[model samples]
Target: MPIIVTPRHNSPEFKEKCVRLVLEEGRTVAEVAKEMQVGRNTLHGWVHQAKVMSEAVNRAVEAAVAEALRAEREESDARAAADRAEIVRLQAELATAREELAKLKGKG
Candidate 1:
């Protein structure tokens, strides 16, 4: 005859803490599960869920950083355009002033 085992229910908080002990506290899943009196497979599943959640958060952060970089590049391009226009205007004014000075010297 085969031995039958009953399934145990654990709260969300309990599962989270157990997963944290394995991930953050450097404890093994088998060790934690053994200490917590839970099944090793169940603890492993919690750890897997935690890893998936962490990867999702990392992706979100990377996307946000990429967006910020893009916006910064756009602002920089706008500033460069404005600076180039100013430089062109200043050069034209300088050329006109030089021409006037040359004409006045010639008249003298």
Candidate 2:
């Protein structure tokens, strides 16, 4: 007689599908578990784990956005400072040109 064996661990894709069926289809864990031949508690645990992972992913995304914004702001500030320096340099050059013109006029 051949012995029967069931796998102990479910694949991540299967776990995701089971979680989605319960979450997206508005089905009860027990109902989905019964249909899928999984233990009710195991399905419930999968759902809980999915929710936790979703929250963690959301937090990570928010943090990344904030970091990107901070870096953009710093870059903008640096550009603005460079612009101000260029403007000051141009103003000083104009002043020197004006001073030279005044001296030439006085000498002429």
My TM-score estimates for the predictions, one after another, are: 0.79, 0.84
Clashing pairs in 1: none
Backbone clash tally for model 1? 0
lDDT agreement of model 1 with the native:
0.88
lDDT per residue for candidate 2 within 68-95, as digits (tens), equals 9999999999999999999999999999
Identify the runs in model 1 with alpha carbons over 4 angstroms from their true place.
1-9
Q: Assess candidate 2 and give its lDDT.
A: 0.88
Deviation in Å, model 1, residue 85 alpha carbon? 1.7
Candidate 1 residue-wise lDDT, 28-84, digit = tens: 998998777778888899899899999999999999999999999999999999999
Instruction: Supply every candidate's count of residue pairs whose N, Cα or C atoms clash at under 3 angstroms.
Output: 0, 0
